[model samples]
Target: MSTVKRWTVDVLVNDDEGRTYAEACLHSGEADTRLVGIGRAKLNPADRDIPEIGDELAAARALCDLGQRLLVEAANDIEAVTHEPVRLRR
Candidate 1:
């Protein structure tokens, strides 16, 4: 037998003044857990005014941080079951 699970990640991006901020939220139905990650991108003085680029960068960084947090959470769960320290790698 096999089991199938569903997970969802929502990313919201906002731009203010020359800076972009992103928040990534992860929802796991199986675990009933929620995790959030935040990221920001600042426009360099010499850079051009491209809002899309900043949004992309900020969202990517936020997702990356969310992934790391998920890994750590998984490691903690495993350690709890095994009674030993565990490290998870991407």
Candidate 2:
């Protein structure tokens, strides 16, 4: 059998002292699968000011971290059920 579900993610950024912090929240619809991840980027005082660039970089980092974590959890679950190591596919 096959099924489909929808997941949602929201990212928010905060700026302080040339630093941008982004937090990503992922909701998997299931009660036990909510996840949150955070990432940070710093702007050099000598460089040109570009808020959008910083926001994009920070948000992308946060999402990548979140994806890594989710994959880890999935691997753990697979190992627990199968009693074997999981070699994640590339």
Candidate 3:
């Protein structure tokens, strides 16, 4: 028999600059792909096929990567303002 699973995904950020962001998500109607499954808080890849965890973490990773790029861009801006070397070594 086939099985359907549910998952919850959450994102959180709390910075020292008095800023906070948080989100929670529930995903349903998800089928066992013979490639993936669901845990209490994450959608994980199936053990026989993929065996990794965290769609949520994967999304967070992409966001963090973009954030790092933006941070470097901001630093480059500051360097331009101060005539400093923009060593953007991404």
* Best-matching candidate per TM-score: 1
State which candidate, 1 or 3, has the greater TM-score.
1
- Over all chains combined, what TM-score does candidate 3 have? 0.36
Report the lDDT tens digits of candidate 3 across residue range 1-90: 996566443444322222223233323235321112112223323433221333344445545554565567668778979998776555
Q: Estimate candidate 1's alpha-carbon lDDT, on a 0 to 1 scale.
A: 0.94
TM-score to native of every candidate shown: 0.93, 0.89, 0.36
Q: Pick the candidate with the highest lDDT.
A: 1
User: Model 1, 1-90: lDDT tens per residue?
Assistant: 999999999999999999999999999997789999888999998999999999999999999999999899999989999999997769
User: Worst lDDT window (10 residues) for model 1?
Assistant: 80-89
Model 2 over residues 1-90: C-alpha lDDT tens digits? 898888999999998777899989998886558888888889988999898888888998999989888888889989999999998863
Q: Weakest 10 consecutive residues, lDDT, candidate 2?
A: 30-39
Give the better candidate number (1 or 2) by TM-score: 1
- Root mean square deviation (Cα) for candidate 3: 19.1
Candidate 2 at 55: error in angstroms? 0.7
Candidate 2: C-alpha RMSD to true structure equals: 1.6
Off by over 4 Å in 3: 1-54, 86-90
